[model samples]
Target: MPRPIVLGVVGDSGAGKTTLTRGLIRVLGDEHVARLNADDYHRYDRRMRREMGITPLHPECNHLDILTQHLLHLRRGEPVLKPVYDHRDGTLRAPAYLRPARFLCVEGLLSFHTETLRSAHDVRVFLAPPEDLRRGWKVTRDCTRRQYTTDEVLRELDRREADAIAYIAPQRAYADLIVTFTASRTDDPSHLDADVLLRDSLEHPDLTPLLEVDHGGVALVRRGRDLLLRIPGDLTAAQVTGLEESVWDRMSFASHLRARRLGEFTVGTSLRRSNSLAIVQLIVLYHLVTARATVALGGDPVRSEWSAGVAPEPT
Candidate 1:
């Protein structure tokens, strides 16, 4: 049997973790991917957190040990009764059964809080969007989906900022890839540009060929200790298709990656596609496919710690 490949995605509230995870699911197919949200391990519900003056972002509010044990179970291809946290009313639902699949995507604010859990992942990603954009995303999401007013969302953001800095932001240092999405034009969140920091520690497939062939919108540069790929939102659909095709060409054995329309997010009742997002998804998918290949060839893909970072910055 092929071992499962786990990808740990950590980020603060309103970061693009869910968006990225959703795209990977679309590409890999739901049946072949198992999804787990670390937020479900919260020890207290919404009212309890408020009464105790504790935000859900803190470690005390969560069951970190149980979460680590569950991660280990999943890594060993076992089923776990994962807790479910209902975001609609900030309550806990009944536990749900989760079976391991070819790929496991564990995403939440504290997915990498412990060494044991971090060691189980084949890839660790951190989403670090600009504060203003993240705030906008939070406000919009809370208002539309969670029944919160704009003011209430802003207040909650202020309350969580401290926990975010102390507990959440520190996880970036352990991520193999740091993904940041910023506005392409001033005051325009619709067209966002992506800056992906590929750390030196991991053995990543070279994307230089795509950058060279499509130099108009995609550019690669070195930043401190990581390689940064800037993906502009202005790229036309044809340009995006070409880059996606180039990536697919290199991984022809990854038949599941033939799907192009993946990870579409809703914006005020409409779905949208991002050129930058597409590239990021393709690169991540490449890693997962190659890791699986390594296992098929009787090699250990999880031999090294692809989690630690070395002063990665956006160029």
Candidate 2:
């Protein structure tokens, strides 16, 4: 059985993390998955906020310790006393019971705020939409849902940018997957934008299907003295179609973004050092690195390796 897995989707406000999480929930199904929006972890009550003078976005403002504790409990297969934040009233409504399921998805700002919080995630995905798209989404969301004028929203966004960098940005270095949706170039991005998702694909080190060179087959070629590829072999139409289909499957499996159009970008540990972008990238790297670490430690390589080493040792 798979250990309890927790996936975190972190990004700037209106970066489409919620939409992505919802889509995954539909795909993965509710019976096997649980959702926890990190917004529920905010510290200030509306009255407390009026006194303390801060919103949920501020690091000095939220209950990081309690949120960390709950996540730890959830990972341990225990029910968590989750908080409730009323967006309508801007206050903590009441504590709620959040039971662990097969998969737990925690989505929101500051999900990767601290090492403790970071340790709880098995898969950390960062969603960094382009600045223009993020701003537009925030503007629209604030106006429609948060009851803010355009100017006020923009001002708040500008103010939040600094705090976001300091508190939220550093988390990206640990991300296992970093998703950035680029605006479509063919369309007029200024007026209409299409999302071209990018992923940093980890080459599985096995390219057998990708390089199908055999006797009387396509010739072989080398790239940069590294990227090796086999030339096409003499294949009949049916054989050619089969090879093409197999290659497509290989590409899809290795490709990120669930769509192959984006291709593989790059990933490095250096991503954890920067600010907002770093946090986004680091979160993805963190999961990937953590998964690799588990495999290295002779544990099952999955998102939730933290749940390993809990069972009794056989005498």
Model 2 score (lDDT): 0.56
Backbone clashes, candidate 2:
27
Writing each residue's lDDT as its tens digit, candidate 1 over 22-72 gives 988988889999999999999999889888989989999999998998999
Best by lDDT: 1
| Residue runs of model 1 more than 4 Å from their true location after superposition | 186-190, 302-315
How far does residue 103 in candidate 1 sit from its true spot (Å)? 1.0
lDDT of 2 by residue, 137-177 (tens): 77876677676789977876786787777766666655545
Q: Against the true structure, what is each candidate's TM-score?
A: 0.93, 0.63
| Weakest 10 consecutive residues of candidate 2 by summed lDDT | 266-275
- Candidate 2 segments whose C-alpha is farther than 4 A from its true place: 186-299, 302-315
